[model samples]
Target: MTAASSEAVAGAVSPLGRAGRGPHFRRREKAWGYAFVAPALLLFAVMGVYTIAYGFTLSFARWNGFSPRWIWVGLENYIDLLGGSPVYGPPVRAAALNTLWVMIAVPLLTVAVSFPLAVILNSVTRLRTVLRSVYFIPYVTNGIAIYFAWQYIYEPNGAINGVLGALGLGSLQQPQGFLGNPATALPALIVVMVWTAVPVAMLLYLAGLQAIDPALLEAAKIDGAGWWRTNRSVVWPLLTGTTAIVVLLNLRDALQGFQVFLIATNGGPGDATNVLGLETYRLAFLSELAPTLGLASALGWMLFLVALVIALVNQRMLRRLR
Candidate 1:
């Protein structure tokens, strides 16, 4: 009935105290935790794990997608693509090469453009929200619509050419069409890819910039560091984490780039813009080509492996940066 006795009773009844006393309380908590997570676990098993397993199985078998029958081809599909078969090897190599090119170009260009824009926007005091929204418009806009708009812009007599002509640089015009020329097609697509990708990276960089301590910048300035020098010395080092995230996301997106190429070039001009994702689509769906679902699945798995490796490497770099 005294305060100490009451406190002792309360402590004995408390779950945390009980857990400290014996293992039963902890076991019950673990059971409840699993019960709470069961639905999500089930959903992941069905949607993620099962699908991955099924795809892996399908990769070794030829299926028309409609027929119940799947011809067990084992590693023939992989061999055809990897062993440089006369039919499928060239396109796969070309597509893989292009995907690698994009994986290199898009991320670097996106970061280069976005970081400066983010720095400028972060320094602005007027209409910052409006400016950010304007920059993010392309990311939220309809992809097909943007591709169509960009197609027109890259046309022979389109806005870009018109601007060039008006600038008295009509000689620089690509009358054959930017998308039609093999030399310019991938670069043009890279430009559009960079445009759509920049806003996301810019937002990330802006967040990183805002998270930086004001004292650091002040200290740098007090030490006679100007705008550029302060950023180089203080701000850049602090942003390594954000930069890693931006690079990883951009790299993954570039490696799997499909919709833009699909809508814009369809990997044309003699496969100049073909990439792994588009190649998978062509193999799986195009009626003119042999419907090699197994081959397509092989390419998909290869892409998945490459992405996984790159992600792991980036994660290591991120840790080192930290």
Candidate 2:
């Protein structure tokens, strides 16, 4: 045989040869890959796509959620919701305002606290792991239990009031308790929200700090920059990506989250702690006399759009930083 003929025979016979790359073999490989992914695709189709489509359709219809029939309402739900209808508009608008406050306050406070705390923890040599666990514990703890614990702490006779009395600030005590008072309820909730969010933000900041080169710190020191100045000028700029993530996540949570308000205060004290998410929840699940499912769905979509706009704005601003 010629040299080319021998090589062609070897290539055809080899286990790692053109046969394995043939059309039939490639089709079998693709079939196996699809088989592996089929279950996940099935799950998403049922749980994600179907539910979202159903909810969108429901938003345009009046349904009691149990009735087989749906009355077509067109844009009535959206109008009642956004056009300041006496029945639904006031509470929703107030809740929207409350949600706006949370969206601004939680992210700003979380970043402010977490970044500094992360900086301090990053410098620690002794008990570093333990300290990290301590901070992270709140993030991983049972949510209901944390809310209950904070509820106790906000009680009229709880630790906070006791400390206030001890400090000769008895007149400042809320007779109705922190969560029961209209004036202090939202701020108190904001504190807990910030507390729960801080650890995660701090963890992100800590990871960002560790990824930074040590030489940058040394260079700052050599240039006679103080510790505070170095952090402000050198370290802070490097962690902008981390800050953006932290801020965006917390903003999303603030806009969409309701469990904290639901479990802690139930939007009590004359709607002082009411937020958009909590209002949506109340309309969808809690309102038995009136079926506001359509309205709730409309509100949900509005919230989604608001979050999307704010997130887009945030991304644009962050890009400017870059």
The lDDT per prediction is 0.90, 0.92
Query: In candidate 1, what residue range of length 10 has the lowest lDDT sum?
Result: 15-24
179-215: candidate 2 lDDT, tens digit per residue: 9999899999999999999999999999999999999
Question: Which one wins on TM-score?
Answer: 2
Give the CA lDDT, 0 to 100, for residue 26 in model 2.
88
TM-score of each: 0.87, 0.92
- Give candidate 1 regions above 4 Å deviation: 1-43
For every candidate in turn, the CA RMSD to the true structure comes to: 4.0, 2.2
Q: Candidate 1, after superposition: displacement of residue 241 in Å? A: 1.3
Q: Which portions of model 2 miss their true places by more than 4 Å?
A: 1-21
